[model samples]
Target: MGITHRGTTRRVRAALSAAVVICAVTAAVPAAATAAANATDAVRGPTVAVGGLDVGVERISVATDEGYGAASITPDGRSVVFRSLKDVAGSGGNEVYVHDRSAGRTRTEPIVEGWTPAISGDGRQVAATTPAQGMSTQRIRQHSLDLGILPFGCGRCNEPSLSADGRHLAFGVVDYISHNRRVLVADRDGGYQTIAYLGSGAPARPSISGDGRHVAYQDRAYQKEGVYLWDRTTGTTSGPLEGPDTYASLVQLSDDGGKVVYLSGSDTYVHDVASGTTQRVPDVKGVAIDPTGRHLLYAPHGTGGPSLVLRDLRTGTDKTVSDQPATAEVDSVSADGRDVVFQSAADGIVPGDTNGKPDVFVRRLF
Candidate 1:
């Protein structure tokens, strides 16, 4: 269900302007305990080998102050933006912040008191959800660092994805009465149009192809939700992937528009648009194919908790890039797909419960 309510307002503080100090402490494990925990995790399941590479783990970033919420990266993989709450125990209102790797600096801006920020494919625009004053008036707002705020009207819009050209946007909009959500598309200039409706059922996440002619989304109107594709040029939709289980999430299109990747239940699968063939790429809860279309990075599901997993699609090789137990959920990948950033908890340095306070973390793909 969508978050549909209004309440008190809260302020967000900025991260320290001083240099980022990386301590030697282990994020997921202490040095002495690493060997024993690694052995246990390995025995939980057979280690699948892809491209002669075994999974390795490391910690990239950890939250120190206010909790970070949703995070997104720029196309070039040099910048990241996320939401942060001021007081860990207060109402937890959110504000957007950006981290620039090239400049080695972090900046905070009050974009909106919202969550689920989606950076445009061109890295110029951002679409996010904001709670309305009333229960039935939630809206989605688009912001551009260069152009300021763009006027657009939307109710209960969330999980937004932008096309490669940055001319169009796709998002899930909930219909209040029916309690059903549909995938909708709109021009960057604010022209609203329906893309696909799932009747009484909620439409799954929607992603647009590189050329902006096709869109891939999940639908559950028939039975359980399954990945589906829509040809924008032809104005037709098709799918109901051949599988027993029928739940899917995190739909994403390849940079070249040749393939679609989605989470089918707990496993990640890729489908060839032309051949209609499906294959698995080691199960991961979050998956993204780089803009070059050569590598795939994901957060593999595990009883040891979530960890970032990188896979080379061509070589069929995968590795665990983050050693820390995955703290925050990954939101989006850069257009070039070299870096993955997420929202995590700030525990030790921040003087608050890590689980209650969130922060942003990022890792560069090697």
Candidate 2:
């Protein structure tokens, strides 16, 4: 899944890892290229750079002159849902697209008026947030790739996330008047409950487990500011989980919800729910976690340049996946940590990437 900030609907141009990373890439420059917005054509762009390496690199997004875009990959790693400014048939702004790697086709979502897309494990369902027209609140909508829209009544909510089974949805809500924010998990049956509430500040970026039993969100209330995990079965909330500083936010949650990767004071840490153990991932900006929660795709400064690295949580081994001259943003990783989707402006990542714009690329490291 793609990591999106709380209260933010659009992908920010600045790299999120820059705050703590030394080799984080600079903001990508925009370039304009016109492609059919609703085209279901097979996605075939530049091929992998000529190397005997056993990895494959493919570009998914067309080189467009639009601003920064974002992408998320499903657990099965066969589908990717992303937001882009590519010109659509009638729409003129941001559009959501689903790229099916197995079918080799990309299609626009039914509702194009959305951002910050979250995909289910099976790649069958997606949840996105759209501004409530004429209202001060936001609305969260769920859509099925085959069917049209699913019934989701997330009024006044943003930063929507989905469980692996697509049976549950989690989001953040802010009470503008009282300055209180809460995280809620809603089931497909329309029942929802508040998992965490903050008297002040927003509890952003709620990540739910595959079973919808655990939720990890950022809490910024009074002196307590860190990542907190809420267990539905136990009905208990765990730790402010002291970070390097008083500020911390969720990065990713494992499928079982036993592990959570978070950021604090420019550093990243993974907290184990069962063992109550915290492991600090030094000098690396965390991105997404694989289904097993044992591998992390992160960005680390390397001697070659800024590159994306997949780290083993158990052995502390690191593999540089996106080894390029320019830095790349780690978007989403596959369940087995073999396929990684990221965005970069650096040329030569693939041939004919001369658009001088940021394009989404997937690196299969199997």
User: Which candidate gets the maximum lDDT versus the true structure?
Assistant: 2
Total colliding residue pairs, candidate 2: 3
TM-score of each: 0.71, 0.80
| Residue range with the least summed lDDT across 10 consecutive positions in model 2 | 17-26
- Whole-structure CA lDDT of model 1: 0.55
Q: List the residue pairs that clash in candidate 1.
A: 50-317, 57-323, 58-322, 58-323, 67-358, 68-358, 68-359
Q: Which window of 10 residues has the lowest lDDT sum in candidate 1?
A: 36-45
Off by over 4 Å in 2: 1-54, 62-68, 86-93, 113-115, 301-304, 325-331
Question: What's the CA error at residue 86 for candidate 2, in Å?
Answer: 5.1
**lDDT by residue for model 1 (1-366), tens:** 110112111222212221211111111223342221112110111233446632221122223444555666656776566666653233234555555555454444435645567665555455666665566455666654434455555557766666655677777878888888877666644354576667654546677765666667777665635666666665666665534365666457765666777776667777676766666765565456665555666776666743666677768777554555443332355555456665444343222334555545555444
Q: How many clashes does the backbone of model 1 have? A: 7
lDDT of each: 0.55, 0.66
Tell me the tens digit of each residue's lDDT in model 2 across 42-79.
Answer: 33343454466336777777435643357878777788
Q: Which stretches of candidate 1 lie over 4 Å from their true place?
A: 1-63, 85-93, 135-137, 201-203, 222-224, 304-306, 327-331, 335-337, 346-357
Candidate 2: deviation at residue 268, Å?
1.4
